[model samples]
Target chain A: MFGPFRLTNPLSGGLLWKIPWRLSRHQKYRQRERLRKVDSIVATLDTALARQGESMRKLVRWKAEMPTEEEMLPKDKYTVFDRKVKRYRKAIHKLPKWTRVSQRLNPPGF
Target chain B: MPYFRITLMRSGIGLPEKTQGVLKALGLRKRMTTVYHPVTSSVAGQIMRIKELVDVKEVGTALNKKQMREARRPAPGYYVERRGTAELEPPQ
Candidate 1:
């Protein structure tokens, strides 16, 4: 009878036996801590952008030391910056977002 | 128990409604929404339904969206422990 069963079977591995394995690899313990760190950094950037508002453009130009792109952006939320050029472009986008929140930050200005 | 790290590589768009529904149910709204679920028959079925649209790998623990994103992001590889700007300032 498999009534109200909680079967425990030791799992076997295929490859990569060098790496340690876990038994009850639940999300609550292992993942949440790493997620919290990433979320905090992104939220910090978002807050900085929200406070800077319109002055964000000049701030980005200063940090990047480059002219801003005049073209309109596509309607995509995710952008991967693989090179220094793309990083500059993405910094242009992040400027407004970071500056808008930067105004509220009392940190020593750069 | 190992969890599966499912990343949607191809879009489920223009696919059958049932297949699309499976993707939606997995919290995969776009081409790269990586979701983690415990290794169970139900999750397996979901993955099997849209297997062609995704790249699956079994990990020891489930990784959240942010953690997964950070994991895939390349390292910055540099840090500043001291500032030279203060050294340039005039003495009071």
Candidate 2:
């Protein structure tokens, strides 16, 4: 036989006591996450720059050894040949202006 | 609170009048019309009412009415940096 000192409903408010604490901890967790993202971005950018420098060096060596397009491509009789040449000339004409604008908008290493 | 992105995937034709009414209430005049609304129990309940006819997803913020309308518009693809001053100014 058991003696009951107090009577209470099985459902109680204590179940949700940690909700506010969890909410504030989650907020702190999000802040820490944002800072971690910024740190990762900086590290990634540094590694990217290093890779770009190495690639540029290889590009310079390849350009010195590569044959010119005129030397590589043979002139054969084809229906679209004339049209291709005209398009190539037009592209070459626009190249200077394109280079100038591209340089201004997106500088080297960007 | 976040916003909900609701897009009508299917039509409410031949369904019950109440279901069609819910679609009309959502301002979905036609298929593939996207609308943004703040996430609330009432809105959620309305979506549930016609859940079969639409797709729903939660977004960070609800777009303004004009922006929501513009969201469905196609891109112009080209821009004019300069135009004739006479054309820009209205004729006297």
Question: Per model, how many backbone clashes are there?
Answer: 18, 0
Chain A TM per prediction: 0.27, 0.27
Q: List the residue pairs that clash in candidate 2.
A: none
DockQ for each numbered candidate: 0.01, 0.01
Shift of residue B60 alpha carbon in model 1, Å: 0.7
How much lDDT does each candidate structure score? Answer: 0.49, 0.49
lDDT of 2 by residue, A5-57 (tens): 34334234344433231124454344344333333332333333344342233
Q: How big an interface RMSD has model 1? A: 20.0
Candidate 2 regions exceeding 4 Å error are: A1-110, B80-92
lDDT of 1 by residue, A9-107 (tens): 322434433422221244223233332333343333333344433124433443354211222122111121324552222322233332111211111
TM-score of chain B of each: 0.77, 0.70
**Residue B3 error for model 2, in Å?**
1.3
The best candidate by TM-score is 1
lDDT of 2 by residue, B44-89 (tens): 5576566546667667777877987798799899998887886789
For all candidates in order, state the fraction of native interface contacts they contain.
0.00, 0.00
Interface RMSD (Cα, Å) for model 2:
22.4
Residue A61 CA displacement from its true place in model 1, Å: 61
